[model samples]
Target: MNTTLQQAFGNIDIYLFDQLLKGRFDSCRNVLDAGCGGGRNLLYFLQNGFEVYGVDLHEQAIQNVQHLAQQLAPQLPPDYFQVAPVEDMPFPDNTFDLVICSAVLHFARDEAHFDAMVRSLWRVLAPGGYLLARLASTIGIEDRVESLGRGRYYLPDGSERYLVDEQTLLSYTQELGGELFEPIKTTNVQNLRCMTTWCAQKL
Candidate 1:
């Protein structure tokens, strides 16, 4: 619940935290947090000398990120943070060496919307860049999910989400010509819902 941009990472997705532990970003200097949502995933990047950029559809979130950047990394341009949707970002292609999209894709309205959001993120990812995404999925709890068609599902937690299955993820990874940096893994939260961690490298 701590969304503050402190020197210490607070409330980052566990999958992203694992990548940090594995040094997946050790050599990367330019990082982007798409759907940054209060900059919970950006603390480490700001404090570690990385050129951090973030985008969110919410104006307040963007402002918060800009303030955090100005405070922790004054050298970075104030425009590094912007109010933009993941489906239509303003950055040029191949601009980021690392991109994080946590809990964002599940908000997709439909199939095309999902593809648009993913492609927008992928378009900005530099070759050999790493992409870390954590989103809702029906991977292990397929039987428990109520299908709403076009990738949307009603979860046991009573929320609706655009849930992906293993096959869908693999298909998209192939479509993007990306290689798996880590096998697809899902965590079921006591039948309430399932979240999947997907890590890949652009080939």
Candidate 2:
């Protein structure tokens, strides 16, 4: 990704995460940025006063996170970064107050992978913690761009995403214990296409 695209994605993600973050977490405690790319979201969490742990499948993201943390806040060390998959996070169970899996789950190659990813996130989140996740849905404007081969769709990375709908999300919530569902909106498009955000909390 070029600087321009990276900036745009970063801005969009920050906006989305910020909206869901508000009023949900009362304290700046332990949080996990599952699939946190380059540790950027972890930086946001830290800047906002959260003790953050970043995990990603790619070694580069983990390395970038370490370097970024060293440069941005050298005082916060040791318990911060790891290279791991969302489906099988390396940390112990109930490790974080919040688990963030942004723009990553949709890349899962199948439903099992997606379900496992969600379950793993839920397992790590402490009671009252939340999963602030964003994905490419089939119900947003981006789907059109992606269908035409121009948008940021999770395809090349062995990722398979479903253009999820409201009922599907609701059903998933019901199937899993300890969660509430709140979907987020995107920029208005003539037709609702791919891309959506949702926040789920552990009860």
Candidate 3:
């Protein structure tokens, strides 16, 4: 395997990188990074010939990703990136083969917000597509979080964030008629915060 192309994947989440190693995305030609921030998780996809698209609420973030696309995959159209909130995406239904929502769903204002974002992403995923999300969760350290109400919590890291647990994720997966492609795995960051990697295939 040629690895020189992968070195450009700077600081990507380890769990996501693991999926890349497993060839989970090899058959998916169209990809979306729902809350792509500066395209850190997309370098390999762009350089390796996948039709990459991205959306971010911040216009600057979209611009940065567009710049990256231009430099790495100049053959793509400029409109492949957009500035839009994840709660409601502009794309039509079943638009992508793979959707990535890394470190983004944790910013949801409440349960409603989280669902809206997730649904929007799901609505754009074609049947048999995949959704991969990494978000802050209270799974392992439930007692360590202080509920701030409305699905938000003050984590041990002194930050207030919207967190989910295993049950919530599993319920959503079922409600969406999706099946887990991998087990729900959470990483505990020295009791400060926990991040869960949830990967599922839309049925």
lDDT of 2 at 202: 71
Please, what are the lDDT tens digits per residue for candidate 3 over residues 80-178?
899989877878998899999999999999989998998898999999999999999998899999999999999989999999999999999999999
Which residue pairs clash in candidate 2?
107-159, 137-194, 137-195, 138-163, 139-193, 140-193, 140-194
Provide the overall lDDT of each model, using Cα atoms, as 2-decimal numbers: 0.90, 0.67, 0.92
**Among these predicted structures, which one has the highest lDDT?**
3
| C-alpha-based local distance difference test score of model 2 | 0.67
Candidate 1 per-residue C-alpha lDDT over 39-81 given as tens digits, one digit per residue, 9 for 90 to 100: 8899888887999999999999989989988888999998989
Cα displacement (Å) at residue 200, model 3? 0.8
Number of clashes in every candidate structure?
0, 7, 0
Candidate with best TM-score: 3
Tell me the lDDT of model 3 at 186: 93
Ranking by lDDT: 3, 1, 2
TM-score of 2: 0.76
